[model samples]
Target: MFATSSPPPSGPWAGAARTEPQPRAPLRTDLLDTLMRLHREGVAARETRRLVPDAIEHRDLIRWEQRAARELRSMFDEVGWPGLDVVGEVGAEAAWWCVLLCDRLTAFQRDAHGLLQDAGERQAAPARHLAYLDDRLLMHHGEPQQFGTQHQLFADGCVEPYPVDNPALVAERRRSIGLPPTACRTAALRLLSLTRGPPLDDHR
Candidate 1:
C-alpha cells in the first residue's frame, strides 16, 4: 500500500506498507481505517516532537517514521477517500482543513522525491561535476556542454518563474486554478514569487 523501512517497532505502523489489495467492499474499508490511524499517529508524533525539543534527540527514527507515514496519508487522502469520514463535533471547515493539509503534504512528498533523485545523481558525479534542477534552479559544475543541457532543461520546466511577466502564461495558470482568465495576474504572481540574493521590497 505504501513504502516502508525495515526494522520493526521503529514505528507502530511498520508493516502497513505491505498491505495488499482485497475485495473492494471489505478491503477498501479496512484500508481506510488503517490509513486514518496511521495519519493520526504520525501527526501526533510530529506535534509532540515540536513541543518537546529533546523528542528527536532520543527518537530520531520515530521522527522519520512520522514524516514518512504522514506522506503516505497525504497520497491516499488526495484520492478523496470516502470510507473514513469523521463523525465529528467539529464543523465541516475542520474536515476541509484536513483535506488541504493532506494536499500540501502530498506536494511535499513529490518535492522530496525529486530532491533525493537529484542528490543521488550529484553524489555519483566525478570530482568536478554536479547537476541539479527544479522549479527554482538548474545549477551545475561541469563543462559548457553540460551547462547548456541544464539550461535547456531549466527552460523546459512549465511553471518556472520568468524575469519578464508573460500575461498569457499567467492567464493560463489562473485558469488552471479556477480563477477567471481576466482576473488580475498579480495574485498568481504572488504564489510564484521567489526571493534571491537580496530582498527587493519593503514587504520582506
Candidate 2:
C-alpha cells in the first residue's frame, strides 16, 4: 500500500514493513470466497443493528471485526490490495467492506488506505472506494472528511456530514470518484439507538 509495503499481517504495528507483495498469477478464488464470507457476516450484523439495535451489542461487532481485520491482514500479505485483477470485481467490493467495518483497527485501516489508493491509480480498483476509505480515515481521526461519505446521526433521525473539507467542492469531488451527490446512506439503517439523545452513536 505504501512505498513498498504496509503493516505486517500479524499485528497492526507488530513489526517493520516487509517487501511489497504482488498479486498471485492465477485468480485467488479462495481469498475471494473468504472476503465475500466476511462481507456477508458484516452485512448481517449491520442489518441486525438496523432492525434491533439492542440485539447487536457494540462488543459483538468489535469481536467480529477483529476476526475480519485479521482475515484482511492475511489477504493483504497474499495480494497487496485485493484489486480486481487479484480478486475480481465482486470480491474486491467485499474486501472493501471488510476494510470499512474494521473501525477498531484504525492503524490497520489507515495502512490499507494506501494500498487502496495505489490500486485506484492502477485503474484496477474504483476511485470511489478510495474516496470512501479516505473519508472514513478522516472520520476516525476526528478531522474533516474530503468527501461527504462519513456522517453523524442525530437522535432526531437527522443525519449530517462530519464537516467536509472544501464544502464547495463536495459535489465535484464525489463526481470525480463516480459517487452521487453527497448522499448519506440511511437505507441500511433507518435509525441507530432510537432512544439515545444528542450524542447518539453514528452508523459507520
Candidate 3:
C-alpha cells in the first residue's frame, strides 16, 4: 500500500491528539461540484437506457463519458496522486495521460451529443445517459501511465509555445502555459474507445 503523507496543519487543530481525528478540510468546492454534475449526468444516462430507445440511442453514453472526461481533466492537478512527490521528474507524466483520455472522451461526447440532439424523442435521453455514465465510470477508473510510451501532449487551442532556446526551459514554459497534461488525454481516450458500443438491455 502507498504510504499516506499528511499535510502540515496550520490551524488550532494541529495540536489535537491523533486519537481524535481532525475535521477534514471542506472538500474542494469545484471538485465537489464536478462530482455532482457527473452524477446528475450519470442518472440521466441511466434513465435513457431504461427507455431502450434504439441502437442509435447508444450515442448518449458517449456524450456523458465525454463530459466526465473533460471535467476530470480540469481537476487533474487538484487530484494529486499518492507517491507523486517521490516519483521525481516523472511525477506529472501520469497526469498528462489522463488529460489525453479526457480530451478524446470530450470529443466522443460532442459527437454523440450531436447524434442525440438530432435523434427522435425516444432516442435522446438514452444516448445522453449512456454517454455520461460511461464517462463517469472511466473517470473513476483512471489508468496507470506507461510513461515511456509514445503518448503526445496537447492543449486545446489554449496553449502557446515558449520562445526559450533550451528544450528543458521550453518544456517548463509550455507546462506553465495552458496545457492539459498528457495523462488526462490518454486516460479519457482509453476509457471512451474501450467502452464505445451499444447498450445491452433496452429500457423500453
Candidate closest to the true structure, highest TM-score: 2
Q: Candidate 2, which segments miss by more than 4 Å at Cα?
A: 1-26, 49-52, 155-157, 189-204
Clashes, model 2: 0
Work out the TM-score per prediction: 0.25, 0.75, 0.30
* Model 1 C-alpha lDDT per residue in residues 1-204, reported as the tens digit of each score: 001111111222211112211112223444445445544643443343221224353253244344444544564455332221221112111222232222223344344334334433433111111111221122211122211111111212222222213443644433332323232232222222111212111210
Write one digit per residue (lDDT tens) for candidate 2, span 1-204: 000011112221121112222333338889888987987777555554333344345456666677788788888887899977888766776787678667667778877998998887886666666776887777666688887766565544455556878899988876665555654445433322122212212222
TM-score of 2: 0.75
Best by lDDT: 2
What is the Cα-based TM-score of model 3?
A: 0.30
Ranking by lDDT: 2, 3, 1
In the order shown, the candidates' Cα RMSDs to the true structure are: 18.0, 10.6, 18.5
lDDT: worst 10-residue window of model 3: 1-10
